[model samples]
Target: YTLMSFLFKLMEEGYELDLTYVTERIIAVSFPQDCFEETYLRNLRDVTRMLKSKHTDNYLVINLSERKQELTKMNPKTLDTGWPDFHAPPLDKICSICKAIENWLNADPLHVVVIHCRVRRNLKPPSQQHV
Candidate 1:
């Protein structure tokens, strides 16, 4: 299934969240389109609330998709150090995302930290495979 559909199904699955508690603190993920936009985010009736963790979240979002900017800063020869291309989020950005996830976890008992990004190039056109 597609990512959006998976999120919707997750909501339908009840507390298949025994659940979001799989980790004690953080869960970092890619930004699925406009995660903060009113029109798109409103579709996830499953989530109780969505909060912006820090100013850097925006950069995190940018890095997740259209990785062109981030990739431009790297040397292709040294990029695949066992981790994939998208694994290149800077330490600072990763820290900020952790903070966001932590904040969401503290919000409530039912709060599920939904963090995501499009990670595979399997189905993209040649133009998007490396961007």
Candidate 2:
């Protein structure tokens, strides 16, 4: 659960946070809703120099949490298995997801996008081949 651990990393870096890497440049993260406490930046102070030591690139982030309802809405479907009503994601939805990724990639050569979610969880295994 590397994604789950990212919360600890963010905490280690001084802000209690969480993030999940979906695929490619798309990642999901969580943050405090009410207000951002300054304590986090203070915690990162010790490693500020080390962090600055790395030079990295341009990026843009798109958080779809605002569209959560639309995001999770799924169409009724029929599965080809014993499991009943096992609806698969719609093709149109898949196309939209791909387009979003494509748009992010098109934004910049080195640009990476991280999305923000409302919860902390990872949807992917550490490695391919079904872990």
Candidate 3:
């Protein structure tokens, strides 16, 4: 199912459970889209709150390591590891979404939110098979 659909389903079932001990685990199977927008972030925040209210552990772990590698292979210039040095209005929107996620993760120490991304590629032995 789509991520939003899954989230909606979780919400529907969460209301029936106790509001004090539900565990909400969020696993980001892929990287955030390049065009991440404010509306998407808002939806994320709402979902997090909904889950937390239902007594579920709220955690968002993003797995971007593999995606970065794939993107690099497609276009090295398009994938950047850190904030861009140039100031562009479009970048502000992206930064806001990133900061929102960061703030949410930092709100509570017990709140587990992991941002997983690989900074470097591992070198494989010359004998390794290439597919």
lDDT of 2 by residue, 1-131 (tens): 24345346666656654444575555555544333345423322322222223213333344433323222222011111111122355677556656766875797766555454333234443354287
> Each candidate's root-mean-square deviation in Å?
12.2, 13.0, 13.8
Which of 1 and 2 is the better model by TM-score? 2
TM-score of each: 0.34, 0.38, 0.25
Q: Which ten residues in a row have the lowest lDDT in candidate 1?
A: 74-83
Put the candidates in lDDT order, highest first. 2, 3, 1
Q: Relative to the true structure, how large is the alpha-carbon lDDT of every model?
A: 0.37, 0.41, 0.41
lDDT of 3 by residue, 1-131 (tens): 44456566646744221112222322232223432445334434444454345424544443333344443332222223333222233666567657756776578755544343333225443455373
- Kindly give the stretch of ten consecutive residues in candidate 2 with the minimal lDDT sum: 75-84
* Residue pairs with backbone atoms closer than 3 Å in model 3 (clashes): 22-55, 22-56, 23-56, 23-57, 24-56, 24-57
Evaluate model 2: give its lDDT: 0.41
**lDDT per residue (tens digit) for residues 1-131 in model 1:** 44355456657753222113234333343323423344223333222222122211222111234433323232121111122444476787667656765665576554544333334433555556797
